[model samples]
Each structure stands twice: as C-alpha cells, then as structure tokens.
Target: MAMTEPTIVPESSAVSVSVSGAVVGGLRDVPTTTLADLLGRARVMDVVVRPLWQPVPRVAGPAFTVRCPPGDNLMLHAAVHRAAPGAVIVVESGDLDFALAGGNVCAVAQRRGVAAIVADGLIRDLAEVREAGFPVFARGVIPIPGAKSAVTPLNRRVRCAGAEVDAGDVVVADEEGVVVVPAARAEETLTAARARLAQEAAQSLDDWEKAHRNRIDALLHAGGHEES
Candidate 1:
C-alpha cells in the first residue's frame, strides 16, 4: 500500500459546532433592552455602531468572533465563509480610517444566512449595503480599504468596542445599541428578559407616571427640597 497524506481542516470549522441553533434562537425574541436590564446594564457595547439607515430591524445571534489587525480584514474574509448560518459576524478591527468590509461582503454574508455584521471599526459601500438591506452595525463609514498582510485569528475571544466577547456569546442589537450576553448566562438571561418584557407590557402609562412621580418625590425628599 502507498502512503497518503491526511486532510488538513481549518480551525474555524471546529467552532461552527460549539454553539447550537436552539441556543441562538432563544435570544431571537429577546429585546436588547430586556437583556441589558437583566445583565445590570453592564455588557452593553458603546453607542458607536448605529444602523446605516433608520428603522433597521433587530438582530440576535451567537457571535462568530474575529480579531483582525488594525486596518486589516483578511481574517474577516475567512470568517465570513466559515461562520455558521445565523451567526452574527463580530469583528474587532482596531481602527476607523479604513473599511474592513463593504457591500460585496455584505451580499455574500447575506447569502450565507448570516444574521448580521457588527464591526468595531469602519465599513464602506453604504449605498449598496443599504440597497441589499443587510444589517450592518459599525462605528462609522470610510472610503479607504485596509491592508491585508496580517493573518488574524478567528472564533476566539476578542475585545470589540471596549467589551470582551467570547466566540459563543449571544449578541443582541436593536435601534438602541448592542449587548453581549455570555453563553453560560444565556438561558437565565432569556428567562429574565421574557419576564421583564411581560412586566413592561402590562404596565399602563398612568402607572408609569405614578412610579415616576414617586421616584422624583423620594429624590426631592433626600435632597431636602420637597415641595410644601
């Protein structure tokens, strides 16, 4: 018998199986506000990445984290192809001078069924991205493309927008901002978010006003400025 070489598999292939679709779906219905409240409003990303256009829908999915060198996007290109369907591609590009991705990248990601793209950097091709209707959340937009000399890591823990995000962390984003919920806390946080949503829905405007007044009264009393 002749000797044969074994196949070499990429590391990203291993990460696609780490998180289950059910786990990702659990967060699909949970609003970012509810998740933020349940997590003590702590894990929220800085309010830098906003929707390219107004009224973009909410996005929730497990993170497929990538850490590319500042102004480089080679790893992001690899990640887009390997990330599991419905995974949110989270990239930590350390600068905003150049774009890590553009409209064409968004098109491919959408075809691959990616839930969304969140970059702690910049992106371009806004006109096409808007037309494609793909959800992209990033710090800003730029016209220049970054260097691709560096080989970045994929499916690993990365700091994005000043927050620590592990590969399987659930990311929820809406009109307001993005929040990263650790994988270990997903179930508990989902339950709490559901309860909070229900509680908010059942509260009436009058009840909210009453509560607001009570809080203001308490504050005034504490400051010794309560009205006569």
Candidate 2:
C-alpha cells in the first residue's frame, strides 16, 4: 500500500496568523541575544542547535512546522516543496542516531526559497551543505541517512530544541541561536525590540557602563555589602 499525505487540520480550528514583512525585517535587524532578553530564556532554542557553518546570515520568517517521526524523515522532505517562499522550515524530532536530511534536501529547500532549516535531529553531508551555503541548525551531523517511511503532516505545533513552535510563528535565527516569536505577539515584540535597539543606539558605551555599574552597586548595597 502507498503512503498517504498527512491531513491538514481545518484553518478555523488552528488560527494561523500571518507574519508581516515589517516584522521579519525588524527581527533580522535585532540580535538573538536581544530577543532572548525580550522573550526570556524559554523562548530561545538550546545552544546545541547552532549553525552548521559560522558566519551564516540571520534568517527571519514565519515557521512552517514539520513533525518527522523518530527514525524517519518523510515529512521534512515533503515540507520543502509545500512550504511557501520565505518560510523557515522547523522540524521537531529527537532522533539523534539517524540523519533527518542531507545536502540535496538542504539545497532543494534553499532553491525553493526556504529561509532556513532548524532541526532538533541530526543531518548528513555536512561538507556539501556548508559548501552550498545552505543554513542548517541542528543537534549535529551523522553519516547514516534516515529512512523516509514515517509519514506525518505539515503545519503543526512542534517542540524543537526545547522550544515549542507553532505554525506561522516568527522564527529568527543566526549564529547565536534560534528564537521563536509567537504569532500573536510577532508585531508587538518587533516594536519593543526596535524601541530597545533605538534606545541602545542613542546611548554611548560610557553611559551604559555608568548606569550598569550604578545598578550593581545599588543591588550590592541592598544586600548589606557596605562601601569601603
């Protein structure tokens, strides 16, 4: 028997909010560290899921969530073709023993206009993926390829690298790490991040140091550490 496509849940049931270009652009400008501060540590992905190659450009887009079953990569491969251009393909799988994807898969995803691939599992063909300049942030790499028999669906909630990601959530990632902005708060977070960025830009290093030092001194004083 042939495998069938995963059933997409009705849109009415799952409210997929569209992320705007302004949000994407603003997020790309801001740092993941800044977003981490804004979103808290829980919103940030684990440090283990880092860029395969250093100096990779930051990617920001609405997530196209994919859930690949353990030991199988059927859904992730299907996602490249289904995801819209500028979508960040986020895969949720804890399978470390097998690779979820390889070089060609990354290339195809890139050619199809995917912003990047953030996987909790491993991938093969590190050299080829790096040479192609495709962005892949995952646990690590493995030589053995994963079987593509486990058929799952597209656009679903998934947990990738300790962060729960829903479809259409704003995904901002770069060298630092990946951060997911909930769809409902995408614009709100962007405005706040931009404001914080602007404020920081206006202040000089000396100004920041003085304020930072003062804060530490006050906290220490409150803690009963008397000034000598």
**In candidate 1, where is summed lDDT lowest over 10 consecutive residues?**
6-15
lDDT of each structure? Answer: 0.81, 0.88
Q: Count clashes in each candidate, considering only residues at least 3 apart in sequence or on different chains.
A: 0, 0
In terms of TM-score, how similar is model 2 to the real structure? 0.92
* Per-residue alpha-carbon lDDT of candidate 2 for residues 56-100, written as tens digits (9 for 90 to 100): 999998899888878998888888888889989999998989999
Error of 2 at 43 (Å): 0.9
* TM-score to native of every candidate shown: 0.89, 0.92
Poorest 10 consecutive residues of model 2 by lDDT?
6-15
Kindly list the per-residue Cα lDDT of model 1 for residues 127-190, writing each as its tens digit. Answer: 9988888899888889998876677557778888877888878888888889998888887777
lDDT of 1: 0.81
